[model samples]
Every structure is written in C-alpha cells, then in structure tokens.
Target: MIKLISKTALLSVFVAFSMMKSQSVKEILNQEGSFRKDTIFSIKSDSKETYLPVTIIKGKEKGSVFTIVAGIHGYEYPPIVAVQELLNEIRPENIKGSLIIIPIANVESFQKRTPFINPLDGKNLNTAFPGSSNGTPTDQIAHLITKEIIPNSTIFLDIHGGDASEDLLPFVCYYNRKDIPENTKKAHDLSLKSGIQYVVSYSYTLTPTEPAKYAFKEATQQGITALSIEAGKLGTVQKDNVDLIKTAVYNMLENSGNSVKRKSKMVNQKSIVLLNQQDYIRVPEDGIFYSELKSGDKVKKNQILGYITDKFGNKKHDIVSQTNGIILYKVGTPPVNKGETLFCIGYNE
Candidate 1:
C-alpha cells in the first residue's frame, strides 16, 4: 500500500521542476571560485549545429554579474584574442564580482573564416538579438545568449572590430534611447569610464514601438545596462588593438567594483556621436573599392572618400562624403558589393 501525497509536497515538487528548468544561469552564479568553462549546445538542423563556448569566473565573494562577449563577427580577431587571454589571466580569487566571457560568439563563422554573416543561416548574429528558439543556427545562438546568458547579467559588453575587409577606429558605443533615459545614461557613463578614447552615442534607428536589432541595444531594452566596443582594423589580431580591448575590459571590471585596477586613462570627455545610420555611404555598385581614406581620417563635405571600379577596371562612381566629419570606418579591401557600406563618418558635437 502507498501513502497519499499532500498538496504541499506536490507544490514543492512543481517548484523544484520549474527551478531546474530555468535555473541554469542561477546554478552558475551560485558556484564559487575558479569555475566552469564549457560549451552550451544550442541546436542541430540540416545536420549542422551551433554552440556557445562560455567561461564563467565566479568570485570568492558576491557582487555584480558582468558579461563580456566577443566575436559576434568572427573575422574581427582582436576582441576574441583579448577575451581568450583574459580568461586565462583572470583568477577567481582576485575578485569581488562574477564575470562571464564568451570568447568567440560566432564559432561557425570563425571556423569558415566568414566575415559578418553566419554561414549556416546567412544571418548577422549581432542583428538577430532577443532571438527566436525556432529560427536558424544563428538565431538559436542568439536565443541562447538572450535567454540563458542575459538573464544572469547585470551589465553586458559586446565587443567587435573591423572585419577582414574593413578599417575601423577604436571606439565605444552606448545607446542613448530617449524612452529609457536612466538605462541610457548608465550605459553612457560606462562608455565614458571605458578606456577606449572614442565614444559614440546613437539612438534607436527605429521608433520606440519596434525592438532593437543590436545585441547591446536589446540588452538595454531588457533593463540591463550595456555598451559596445569597436577596435582593431582589417581583421588581423593586432597586438595594440588586443591590448586596447583587454584594457577596456579591465577598466570595466574596476568601474563595476570588481577590485581590479583600471588600466584606463581619461578620454577627452566630449560628446561624439554617429551622424546617423543613414550617414553610412554605400557602394554605388558591385565593384572593387579604392580608398585612400582609412578610419579616423578627417574629411570635408563632398570630398571623394573613395571610388569603385568594375572587375574589368571600368570606373563606376565616386564615393563622396556627405558631411565634414571623421571617417569612423570604411571598406579597406579591394572587393566591394553594391549596397554595402563604403564608409561611415562621425562628427564631434
């Protein structure tokens, strides 16, 4: 004969099941000291799959939960190298808060040497945020980040750099959303505290009714303070750029009360913002791009930033600057495609 189950016991069982289902991140946070470095398998489809290789460094004592992610675009190597080195360098005992690091967010793209889009699903992983579990490999990875990693984070940093075909200046970006002024201001302050010299502020491209397409923006939308760092150029792992990213992360840790020294020097502390997403000059046609202008070059209004030529060496069109500003980033390689950003300019305000 079996004893009858009580309602209290049944409720306890239900609660335990729910926690087990949703508490993967909580379990990680509960762990102490030097801890787990593992892969989260997201999904498999068409005999292909995606994974999130993560490193969780829980402190000896409790504090804020900080998340750092790199390689959203695989060919951008500096942040990936920097985060990888950081994982090895940071000791669990030397902290006051938890740190989560994702060295290479786009592993498949990295393995395939693809630049911006995920080869498996042809989606830009950065743009697939707050993702759908029912979507492609890229979407699934984004889903894992949004669902699993983000819920545990109090602050999020998304690191990026120029891909193999572009030139980009070292900078940090924070969303200045009008609707969420407090979160926006917090992000702005963190960007200022970040060691990187250039600070870029941008608002949502769309109206407040639509969701943000960027990782940091989406995280900010979810009430998590977020910032983005862009450094290095033309894909190769430049040591200076890697060091720059490392210093920025170190600075972030210090700013967040992690008992770490800030490896940062004070910046100019001016308001520098991207003119607009529409300010990016697109390639006039599918052709080879020729540009004397690298990132960080001062330019004049109507200046010929670059030109494009067809495969047979026929002239296409002159890529001209629309405003007097600095070149924030531009296509550095010869290959170019129609509708791709030839360059973007930012002004000091």
Candidate 2:
C-alpha cells in the first residue's frame, strides 16, 4: 500500500509539472516580441513584382508609430541608403514604438535607374498625392501611402536628395503655418534633433501640382508631425552623407524613447536658418550669369547681386536684389533665359 501511494504521488507531481510547462510555452508563443514582415502592396505587372518594399518593426512595448519613407524619386539614392541603414540598425527589443520603413516608394522609377515621369501618363510620383484607386501606377502607389500608411503614423520623415543634376544643401523642410497643431510642432521639434544643416519652412501654396497635392501637408493636416529631409546629389550615393543620415535617424529614434542612446549629440542647434520670404532676381534677357556675391554673403536692396552677359561678353542685364538679405543661391551654369531666376535673397526681417 505504501509503495502504491508513493507511485501515485510521483505521477501527480509529474502531471502538474507538465501542465505548468505547457502553460509557459503558450505564454511565450503569445508574447509581443514576435516581429513580423509583410508586403502591404503588390505590383500589378505580368511578372507580378513587389515594389515599394516596406519593413515594419513592431516593438514589444506600446508606443508611438513612426513611419520613415524614402525613394520618392527613383534617382535619389542617398535616401534609400539611409533608410536601409536605419532598418539594419534597429532592434525589436530596443524599440518602444512601431517603426515602418518604406525604403523605396517609387519602385518603378528605381528599377529604371532613371527619373521616370511615366511617359504614358506624364506623372511624377512625388507630386501625386492622395492617389487614386484606379488611376495610373504612380497614382495608385500614392493612394496606398495616403490611406494605408499615413493614417496610422504618429510621426513621419520623408527623405530625399538633390535631383540628378543638382546638389542640395542638407536641409529639413517643414511647413510654417499658424494653423499647425501642437502634435505637429512636437514632431517638428524632434526632427530638428536630426542635426541637418538647414531647415526650410514650407508653404501650402508652393507645390500646386500632383505629388505636392498629397505630401507632408496631408500628414500635417492629420496632425502628424512630418518633415522632408534632403541629403545629397540625386542619382549618386554618397557614403558620408548616408552615414550622417543614419546617425540622425538613430538619434531621432533614441530621442523619441524608442531606442537606447549611442550618441550624445544628434543635431547641430546652431545651424543656419534661411527664410524663403525674399524675392528672386530674374534675368531680363538670355545671357551668361556672373555672380558678384556668394550664397552666404549679405547684401543690400538694389545691390548688384550678379550680371548677365551675352556670348560676346556684352552686359545685357543687371541682377539686383529687391530687399536687403543674404544671397541664398545663384545660377550654377551660364546662358540663362529671359525671366529665368538668377539669384534668391533671404530678407533680414
């Protein structure tokens, strides 16, 4: 009888242990650290390709949802590299909020390695906003971003570079409107922490075309803090700029309490701020432009900002500023057309 009782006790203890193990296993399986990757949109081609690859890193803890988008223009390669770097560095354990990264928004443009305007439709993906369901390929992609992506995001960062022939100064563009809400301000402040050199206050009236129709403006309208970052020259990937961008992104995530701090300083608070309220000096006739002032030089109103000369060195026009401000930019090449912008001056007001 004693032996039988001992045997029964051992059996009961074993069963209890097994039950406990099973419960623990189930709990582990249901835990939040399980990261998942999915394709939000599939390309509609004969090959049935997947463009605009998005990677979502859902954190174990509950926090804000941040969306980082790049490659809005196919030729802009630096932004793509920056996004990829951000993806590879982010870890699920360190993330408090969800991070959704769309590394290449214009997949068709990217694949072609040329800036595509969709000859059949004459559409630029950057300008197509709130895209249509049954519209062109670019339009549909834009729609997906507006409906599926932007709505859920609490903060957004749209990355880009200069176009194929231009080299843009590293800057962050934010709309400066009195109607901007508090949440948008918060996100904008965080964006300043990214340590870029310049910040352009965007206006709603600037982009009247398609892509601008549904851009950072839409995000701001939804009360999401959004900023557009310009990194390097378009079509070419610069390693230094990419590294800087990666550092800035990491800093933003860390500052937002989404990850751990690896760097003490992420932004240059003393960076130059250029206001876009100045008038542009237009060339009166077709001529070669010779600038008398540099981009950062200050000048007075009616000053000889530059001169336009003909092919035989005949002065045709005098480029003058309308207000006292700094010369922000000048024509890179010569032989400009009449009424073409020769210089831009930012006022001191």
Candidate 3:
C-alpha cells in the first residue's frame, strides 16, 4: 500500500514552484484523487542553505510510491538530465502510484560544478544516510529524505554515473541484505528489470543493526525495495546513457503498474553478474596516470592495466590487475591523488 506523507512535515516545506500552491502536499496526502505538484524543500544550516526541486505525482487509484533520486553526485549529468526530461514525459492522470522525483539531490554541488562530494560541507551525500537534523547541509538533506520520503515510498531508485574524473560502464546494483530476504528479492528483481545488461550487487559491510551508508541502502534497511542505476561516463552527458536511464526508469515503473502503458517494452537482457567485490587499483601517491584502456576492457591477472608517473612524466608505478576481470570504471583524467582509485575491476569467478 502507498503510504501518505506526514501532514506536519508537509507544512514545513517551503513551496517555490510557480505552478504549485504551498497547500498541495497537505491537500493531496490528506485525501488524494489525482494530483501532481512541483515544489521545493529547503534545507538550511548555519553555513549552508539550499533547496531540493521535487515533483510529486499521484494516480487516481492508490498504489506504491515509486521514488527516483538523481544527482547525489552532482557532476553526473545524464541521470540528472534524464530525470528532468522524465518530468515532462509522465503525467499524473496516467500514473497508478505516487512518484517522488528529486532531479538534482545536490543542487549546491551541481551549481558549483563540484564532483563526488557536496561543495558546501565537503560531504559525500551518498555516504551520509539517515542523517542528522542539526548536521551539515548534506546531512540535513539526507535526513529529510530518510525521514520524510523513504517512509512514504514503497520502492526507490537512486541514479548515478561517472564523475568528472571517472569513466564507468553501465550497470544496475542493489544491496544484498540477507537479513531481509523478501526485500532483497524485490530489490534484485528490480535490478534485472533495468534495461542495463550488466547487473551487479554490493553486500552490506555493516551489520543489520547499523544504518546503511548509501541512500538506496538506507531505503533497503528501512524495508523499501531500492536500486542504484549507473551509466554515462566522465561527467559528460551521452544521449545513449540518458536514454538508458529513461528507458530503465520508465520500464521499472511500467512493470510496477505505476506508469502509463507504453509501446516501449521492458528489456530482458543477458545479465553479467560480477560474483566478487570490485578489485580496485588505488594510487600510492599523487601522480599523472596513463591508461589506454577504458571501461569494459578485459584484463588478465597481473596484467599492466595502466602506469602512473611523477608530475615530470617519469614512471613511478605500473598498475596491474589483481584478477582476470572486466574494468568497471577508471579515473579518466591525468591528475591522480594519493589513495584515489586508478581502476575498478569486476569478475564472475
């Protein structure tokens, strides 16, 4: 069943959307028929003040609340752009469930052109799950989603892509939370429904007692089915990648009976599941990295994946793959920092 948003919490949200009145959320959540509202939720702290752009849509019949969040890593443009485009494609009248869309979760980082972490508090918004109310800007934002949105949603998808310095292959991932078997099954089922062919999963490093670190992980911990969809590369918007997100999200929504009937059918792809955790090469020191291989390149055990050099172009280290696997992602730019990932490999064996 689709849960309703808290009436008290809805009033605290400041509405900045020109088309929506401030009372829309309260009115819709209290007794909803069919409504779609565009609004903004503000997060303020002593040092940071930013707002999230949100779109809430409900169908005539009540169903699951399917939430889609993009721009947790602000530099990733494709998913962000895809979500914005989705806003235009979907209408409330045709939907069967509620949709809580957060197009750009880190507006501050997006505006400042920051990558990986929030520019305001130097925090990775994805890592700050179940955040503190009095914490940093990113923390407050996470808290809002965890407290306000996650509780009201039945299914969630957090979309991401390669940051400015990284190139990544397209894949779909969900947390392997064995403690919650039923929820895990739902999440895994959603990953397979994603249009992406490469399906991967991450096991929880933390125990069931601990709150998860990632946004989708937190949703899983809270009993909501969630997934993380990755695409695009090197911070640039690729039309193919953008369309992939569009197709995957709409496909998932359509399957869950939350979206309008469409001619585009859901794809059943040949899923390549990486059986092991990602084997990564991290730099020992700041240097310039050179690699001819891109994401999806195959590598053999002990093969020279790349080389790192001192700033003056003298080789310092020859990066080698630890196992035979396919490269999932790599730092795309030249400048490398100590402990930064040079390459990430995934394997079935």
Which number leads on TM-score? 3
User: Residue 200: error of model 3 in Å?
Assistant: 0.2
Model 2 stretches astray by more than 4 angstroms: 1-40, 45-50, 116-120, 204-214, 261-264, 267-300, 303-320, 324-348
Residues 95-135, model 1: lDDT tens digits: 67788788899998898999899999899998888677677
Query: All candidates' TM-scores?
Result: 0.86, 0.73, 0.89
lDDT of 1 at 24: 70
Query: Clash pairs of candidate 1?
Result: none
lDDT-based ranking: 3, 1, 2
Looking at model 1, residue 112 earns an lDDT score of 92
- Summarize candidate 2's per-residue lDDT along 54-78 as a digit string, tens digits: 6777777777777889888878889
Which residue pairs in candidate 2 collide?
Answer: 126-211, 127-210, 127-211, 128-211, 195-267
208: Cα error in model 1, Å: 6.4
What local lDDT does model 3 show for residue 76?
Answer: 98
Clashing pairs in 3: none
* Candidate 3 lDDT tens digits, 112-200: 99998898899999889988777888888888787777777889899999999989998888878788788778877777776678877
Superposed model 1: Cα runs more than 4 Å off: 1-21, 32-39, 205-209, 260-278
Candidate 3 weakest lDDT stretch, 10 residues:
15-24
Error of 3 at 28 (Å): 4.3
